[model samples]
Target: MTTPLKLTEEYIFAHDLREASAKIYRASTKALLKHFRTTPIEEIDHRAVLAWRKKILENGLSKRSWNTYSNHLRTVWGYAIEHGLMTHTTINPFRKTSVVPPKRASKTINGEAIQRARNWLTSLVGQERCTQERTQITPAWFWLAVFEMFYYTGIRLNALLCLRYKDIDWDNKMILVRGETEKTHREFFLPIMEGLAPHLCRILGEAEKIGFSPDDQLFNVNRFSRHYHGKEMNIDQVESIYRKLTDKIGVRMTPHRFRHTLATDLMKQPERNIHLTKSLLNHSNIATTMNYIEVDYDHMRAVLHERSLAQGALSRVRRVDSSGTPPTSAITAPSAQIRLPSRKIADPKPTTLQPPQQQAAIEEVIIDRPSRSSGPSALRKALEFASAQLHSGSMESATDSPSDQIDQNLLLTLMASGLGVGTFRKRTQSERSMGSTSFSRASP
Candidate 1:
């Protein structure tokens, strides 16, 4: 005869959750209580739970919100079954009822907007207070410290609010995060960075002057608010301050956006250590940290630009001709030729040959080279030089060394296909003689 409301109250009491977690749990169960008030836990079946889910969507609640509420209820039901509040045969209707929410890209705050807000806060920090103020320190200085801590450390709003004076270790330069304040309920430590140390020290000095004990909240609300003077500042009051600043800066500002911005900026660094960023942000899983980062297209473009082919080592094009002289009538000058270091090759033995046979052999070698469909203009010029050499009858008078002739053919192949010549094996004497005979018969 136990009801969901009674079970939820018992579950909350048994678990001893933190204030924030307990508040969320109460709110989640409140939604269920609206639909199933006074209904027995054994009588509420899957159909009733489905009807409640439909009503939530009808009320304009998002799938993400529906999932969150269902998760809390499901956990409560599981706890009831474990504690013998519910029958072992009874089914948990809330289990496996969540739908995957559609993913939306998270927009990061613009760097210029953040800079403007920081500048505004800095100006406020420097201003002198009027005589009417009760405290010597202005509220702006306290808010400035909070703003810098959010920017530099990227701590969550809840954890930041829960921070105490004793958590800071000045000698170790670290701040201990309590498990109760963390979303994952795990204790961890964060380093006090160089840029953030000064602001923290200033705030600590002010807190000491006010005689705050080690267990008291680090950020004193008393400096600014008369109502919350002795009490710790809550989320709504902090959000109200950000909303006012958003209006002044013409850009929306929130505590979570600071976490997103810091995560993205760290990812854009040259090292781009994602694991390090996860550790800094105190994320339970690396995947959760990944969702916080936004792609920096400009930085990606700069990296890709540096790898372009036009600016690479192979950009300079050279033409190789066996005649060792530039063609005058048939071939035009190349656009440019950059001198590159050449490797030495052993000279080959001289081979005697008839003039006609030599001319036909050179022609066959030129025609046998692979065709390039997308060859550069330099490759076209090389083919033109070969035609000029054949028509000008310069092959008979050529006395180039065998190594020079082989290098000429290798270079022509390289220019045509943009491939390295190392893989192209040299033709043997028998292969050259065969090519000469084949070209001699085919000549018109």
Candidate 2:
């Protein structure tokens, strides 16, 4: 029977993973080896796995870290089963383990903070150029270029570090991200954006001055660092630079934050093409890219304000004052018409108190014509027509025919009622003062 340690070793050797991946695998199983030691691979059960998980968590490892460890062990067990090192009946201890929810939320760096950092970096580089020998490029300049590249490209740090002069396609203006340097282990190309072009050119010139061939790393540690001379720049060294900068500037700066910031800024654009953003980020799945974006509440609020229904209604009301008629397509007949109930008008009493010669007239006004529809366009046309007739002095003309007067009254009534009861009352008073007849309320 093979021990868990021996099994992990065999698994790592069989997979032939890249150096970064192999390192991660080894680190993932460190706790597992400390607990299980020489125990038989088949003997570890779910209960034991649970106890180990508790121990790992107690040791201050996060749930996310525990999950990663569980996944690697599960993979190693599957590999053992596949290779006949474990019996077919053996179950994966981590198969039923529930993944712990991540504790920290994804975040993007503030643009203001980034701007401050950039200003500081620019000042630092300018000072370095003044103090340093003119023949050699300063480390400050290299870091500034790295910072700009992060801001513009959103490329992963490892992939950016792995880049070589040969990877740049000047003709196509693209950067080739090698598969070995990527987390997904799949190669893809990223466009060299306009903002990043000059920085790239400057860095390339510096690399050439330092005798770096096309095949050599684009950013070399040896060129600028005395301690790291003759050695390659690794992730830790890059992180140390950011750490020092963060201390000086009083902002938490990280390479991954640049990736997050780029995704969010692209998403906040008016176009907001998520697919295009995903392509730029080189994510195999759009869901992964989604995790990087921070919601822009201000942008969302602006969109909502622009497309609100209330604003649309107010705009339609304003259009009613315009001279242009509403489109004919919007003219639909309403199911109801305006009918004025019969009302008795009192005659003026004689000074002598004699009986009035004529009986009081009981007049009824009925507009049997189809009323305009409730739609905004139809209502707008009715109001526009009424307005034109009122402003053209047709209603005020004494020579106006009764039929024309009745038609104008009908339109006025429609407009008033469609607007509101208050408007209806105001219109009635205004029309009466203009010597125009008032519409009576219809009996139910």
Candidate 3:
């Protein structure tokens, strides 16, 4: 029999994180209960509580929000038991309940798309329309700068927004952020990307022009929301500026798109160090980093190319070959498995005379062969070389003699181009799977 005013005030004093807890409690017991037939706290059972949670979750509430609600209710129920307001037999509904939140859907952004977004941002600066007046100096620059900072540092949006001038070290290309702004509440200095140095420098220059102290915020952003007095920037404001520029410049983009794009972009370079990438992304585990990264498209393409070359699927018919003078449309490429009896040329052959040039072509010349070693060092070097060429898109000359084993790229390529491999005997099996689209538009 508690009134909303008395219950809210009394409960808030007992809870440590009073503000957010009170909001959640009011939403659950007051707002939510109004929607249901169940009237009193004593009458509300575990099933009823779970049903409320299910309603909120099905309405697309975040896990963070759910946790807040559950924690608040747990506290309130505990308070009741502690004061003997309810019997001990009156079970706490949410105590052992496991909330298995649905996995959040992710969006994909490729390198080409990221570049287009960046280009639009650059175009936003220094433009004029209609009369002789300069174009609107909106938050596009701030959003772009923020986006570049987000991807380049892999810092959280909250952390990046809170960055002060003193936090950055331009000479070392590093920034020191507070732990409070971070998701983990453990701040680490991150290096700014060299590619984005110029843009960041421009921001610093503007801050300097405005005579900002090291302690002050680097930019006067956030006028889009919160501050009703004059201005204060927020997420929607940042996105609105970005969206306007994107629509005008014809680049499909959003802030989170930059983060996803960086993950994919880093995977593009085979020489990319995973350790460096993990550190940059500030991920706790290597597995989490792997989830965001994708297989390099260039690597896949090279594998396809190798298969095409190996399978003799393609031939370059030059103008001379195409001419009707006395030509074959195709010059046969080599098959890796052209076996012959081990009869040496030096074993004596019944020779017939041929043209000097034709005789030169027929003759086998082994010129200046390198000495081979059986040591581990030599074996290691050979393995390294093979791995480098295979991964780095360097293929052995097609005209060169076939080795004991084919390159793995050539193997993957051949498989894609209809080669029967060891396990995936069906050709073009893997090539058909060009990844999946992450999001789909729902009808409005």
Candidate 4:
């Protein structure tokens, strides 16, 4: 019977996973086999897997770390069942396991931390320039450029370390992240930020002076190595230097923190769109990019408060009136105490009250005429026509008709009320006070 370890080896060879992925899976599988203690492939049941999980957790393995191992075991078992190495009736033990990974802690580096890293790098470059007897530049300049690229491009540390001079487009100011080198396994281009361009140029100058060619890696481990033989710095050595610098500066950080810092800083721009920030970070899912952004609730509340203040100001402007009272047109009239203009029409002509005997005679003459259903409106129109005639200094045709009588009646009725006859009739207070004598005399 084929053992679990041999089946796992077959699966690894068949899948042809990338070098980094294969390495991780092989390590995960090796640890699992070590725990199995010569158990057959088909006999490792869910109970055994559970016990193994407990053992690892007891040994200080986090749930997330154990999940990685369980995930690899599941993949290998899937391959075994497919290839007939294990019976199809057997259930995969890893399928029955549950491991909820903990929430990711914030890896964001602040501006002060970035500045300190840059200052440390700058001091290193100065030290190298002063103490080094050789004319060629030291590794400090290369490390500075590496950190600057990390801040600007937000590429993974491995991708940045592996960048070749040919990957950069000098004229176009863009850098190509090869698909093979990227964690996503897909190629993409990133624009060279203007701030990082000078550092890149300086590195290139130093590389050229040291007999480097266009095909050579942008940053090599030549100066750091005792033999001075140019070799690409592995990820571990790069991380070691980063750790030392951060520890010395008292700003504890990792290289990956720069990626978080870039994403967060870009998203904070007032004019930045969320999708644009996602693309800048090269994130496949916008939710992943969002995890890096820390919104300021206090700032948002302040903006909303300012908006409300502006709206209140506009409401006050609408409430202003010439009389210093609230406008009647406001949304809530009761609150503002606005008064509407009176609707009762004033009489069109003014005169003193006539005596009972004379008033009765005038009413009989006007009321005895054939009454129209539109009484007040017809009388009002007749008064308006006569007033217009008086103002223009014109008279109607000489023919005496019923229409003329109606106009005369309207004038008499208006005179009985208290109103002026348009602009044509103007009487002084003395004339008005003289009562019927002056009023009759003034009438043409």
Candidate 5:
């Protein structure tokens, strides 16, 4: 017995969509009622829908608009069929249309713009203190609270305006967004963040001054007004207030921009926890959260700078002592100017002959030797020195020396030059067996 108009009312009520969403559905359905005012449910056909759609297209409506309006009608029709208000025998004419919505461009807010907005807010607070109407601090406190809450919570503007004093659990330190007010129509709670807590308290104190009940709206629009001061505010009025606030700072921004900026900042943390950012933004799909993160040049530059510094320090060749002993720390200083070992010198052989210059160089090398704790720096230097020796085609000195007296860097250098330790040992042993005089002689 229910008509299409009555069925539309029932469907909207059952869904419990937010006021803004309900308004859109109603507007879309209003177009349908105007076109088929007297048509019976069973008599409405595909031809009638096509004529209505053609008129909408001729009126210069966008594909997104066509899709939205068509979707609204289709949902209502489906609801009617499910409840037996209309027969399912007839095909849905709206679905047969070929309209497609265009892809939306990703939007992001500038960090510098946010900072400028904050500065403007701070200056406004200072100006309020200097005013003669210091007794009425509620208005100033209310706007401050609104501005901070929007920046910190990332909640939708309408959801925030709909918040009541009861929604805040001061004891538990959380704000609950009721399912009725939420865009998703699902209830969720946000933790009271550190920066946002003080502003909440300020507004709470202001509300208490008027004996605010649990059901009273958190933000009083009348208090915020400079001219048309009143008890309540509509969506248009709330947006107007926000526009004026941002205009003062000369930055064009909206409540949703704060959400994007916060999401991007959270994703840029050291951990880069995108899952945590998704939960914070209350996004049902992770892809939606990913869309909010824009490229940050500042963080990228820091990483590249650190990489360059590492390469510069690790790519240098370590210096060798002129006297053929371990190099003095003064001659082969670490690239970072840090007093860490830059190369591994061989264990010295027992003293035999001591030329004055060689003996002085050896003494200085021993006195300036780095501690065992400098292993990492020593390893880096060894790699660098070994690489240099490979390119220069250098060989280990064949002068008087024990097996253990060979430098680790020299061993690595020999290996890089295609001579393993085993091969070098075999060659040395063969020379000894043949009584070769070259075994103890210095290289020419």
Candidate 6:
């Protein structure tokens, strides 16, 4: 009732997953069969399996694919060993071998690239591409809408392609990607970008004229042909569409390229203090975001040094006597007109003096938050003011002391500005009047 290859095929469907994982097993099985020809299962040895793995590796299989194939082989051999089907099968060489990390596709889009792709898609919608065939896509804007969804929301290609009419909320401007309908199998709500929102409204409004149902697909492009019974687009085909779009737009790209570019752009700026690029990309790791967020360290350091020199911060401090005069050094001054500042004037108080014991005691106060700040450093001000009011006497610090001085200084400024207005002044005074410790809860 069962042959070795048939058993292997059944094993494949039972254990492996992720559309790509199964193909790796199938490829490994085919390679093994080709090598062994007529060898029985009990007679198959590690040597033959290793040769199969070697062939797969040599035949241009990616490390990830090889690693996956090796994992399957190991599983099969492990099953055989555990069940006494093959007594000599030991540890799998493939699983034991070091795995090369998979090369992840870029997942973000740059602004310029997004703009170019958007403009191109805009120009294509409703335009006839072929007079002989008497057929063209519904509208080029529809394609751009899909790309915009990915660029703004970081949805997987599969999820975007599977979007149905009901997937969107016309009233709320939210798109509901159902979990069962996603590649990661997790449903998430994506807020519509401002640019795409009206375009979507128009598309839905136009489609409504034809009496489209909520279950109807939003786009009718010939992108997904393989799994949709000739109607819907699947993940791979959706990716292919993006690829073709990028090519047409003259920008090398993939669906994921948008995600990478977006994440990088979100994080890669001198003034980018909010720096929620990872959260924007919906990444689980800071490291994964850093892959694209990597900065030119050499260039940055060089710029920093140049600025330090301009500010006189890079100059070595001259050793001097208590009277505040620089001692002569073997190194001569440069020919530039730059002159060193006066020698350091020591603080009136001794540097070594410690704060009084009473000053170190914990104090806490509570204050009501007014309008929360939305600047790059907004969180700092909101949290710092909240904490300072709780600790009127300066008890404990924030859980994450994010630039404490800046936060405290900003809070002071906000408090002063609030005092300038009569209505706000009462609210601020009442909030500050609450007993200390309102913000700082007792430590466990």
Model 3, span 1-444: residue lDDT tens: 643334445667764442433566777556544545446655556797788777877888776677766766676776776766666346777685447566544555555666676666666544422233333434445556776776576666556667788888998988887766665556778877787687788788877877778877564464321233433334565566567746764665666655566776776766667777776666777787777776666688998999988875654322232333443222222321211112122313222212232222212211121233234454345444544434333233444322212223333343233322222111121113422111111111
For each candidate, what TM-score against the reference? 0.66, 0.68, 0.51, 0.62, 0.59, 0.54
lDDT by residue for model 2 (88-175), tens: 4467787866566664665678888888888877877788778764222246677788989899989999888899889989789999
Off by over 4 Å in 6: 1-24, 36-50, 59-64, 71-90, 98-110, 125-138, 222-230, 234-244, 269-313, 316-444
Off by over 4 Å in 5: 1-4, 34-55, 88-90, 96-98, 133-138, 221-229, 270-275, 284-444
Candidate 3 global TM-score: 0.51
RMSD of each: 11.7, 10.5, 18.4, 15.0, 12.4, 20.4
Worst 10 residues of 3 by lDDT: 435-444
lDDT of 1 by residue, 1-444 (tens): 577778788988998588778788888888888888877666678788988898888999999989988999999898888878887445788888888898865657888998898888777666534333433224776787888888888999999988999999999999989988988888889899998898889878887887878998897666444545547678887887899789989988999999999999999888999998998898999999999998889998877877764465334333444655543222222332312223233334455444344344443233333344544564567645644443444343356644345435545545555422222333445445433211111111
Candidate 5 structure, TM-score to reference: 0.59
Which whole-number lDDT from 0 to 100 does residue 144 have in model 2? 81
Task: Report the number of the highest-TM-score candidate.
Answer: 2
Q: Put down candidate 5 lDDT per residue, 326-441, tens digits, no spaces.
A: 54343223321211123332334332222332222211111122343545556456556644533332233446332223333355443343321221221233224333221111
lDDT of 4 at 168: 84
lDDT of 3: 0.54
List the lowest-lDDT window of 10 residues for candidate 5. 435-444
Residue 404, model 4: lDDT of: 28
Error of 1 at 190 (Å): 1.7
Q: What local lDDT score does residue 264 receive in model 1, on the 0 to 100 scale?
A: 97
Which one wins by lDDT: 2 or 5? 2
What overall lDDT, based on C-alpha atoms, would model 2 receive against the true structure?
0.68
lDDT of 1 at 195: 84
The full ranking of all candidates by TM-score, starting with the best, is 2, 1, 4, 5, 6, 3
Clash pairs (backbone) in predicted model 2: none
Candidate 6 local lDDT, 1-444, one digit each (tens) = 333566566666565355555676677677667767787765555566666667767888788766765677767656655655544446543456536767665444446776786766665653534332222233355556666776777666666666787888877878887766643445567778896787678667766776678888776444321223555545665666667766766677776676666656555566664337654554456776678653546658888989888976634443334554564222222211112223222333312212232222223222433334334355455445654553442334434332232224433554454321111111222123332111111111
For lDDT, the strongest prediction is 1
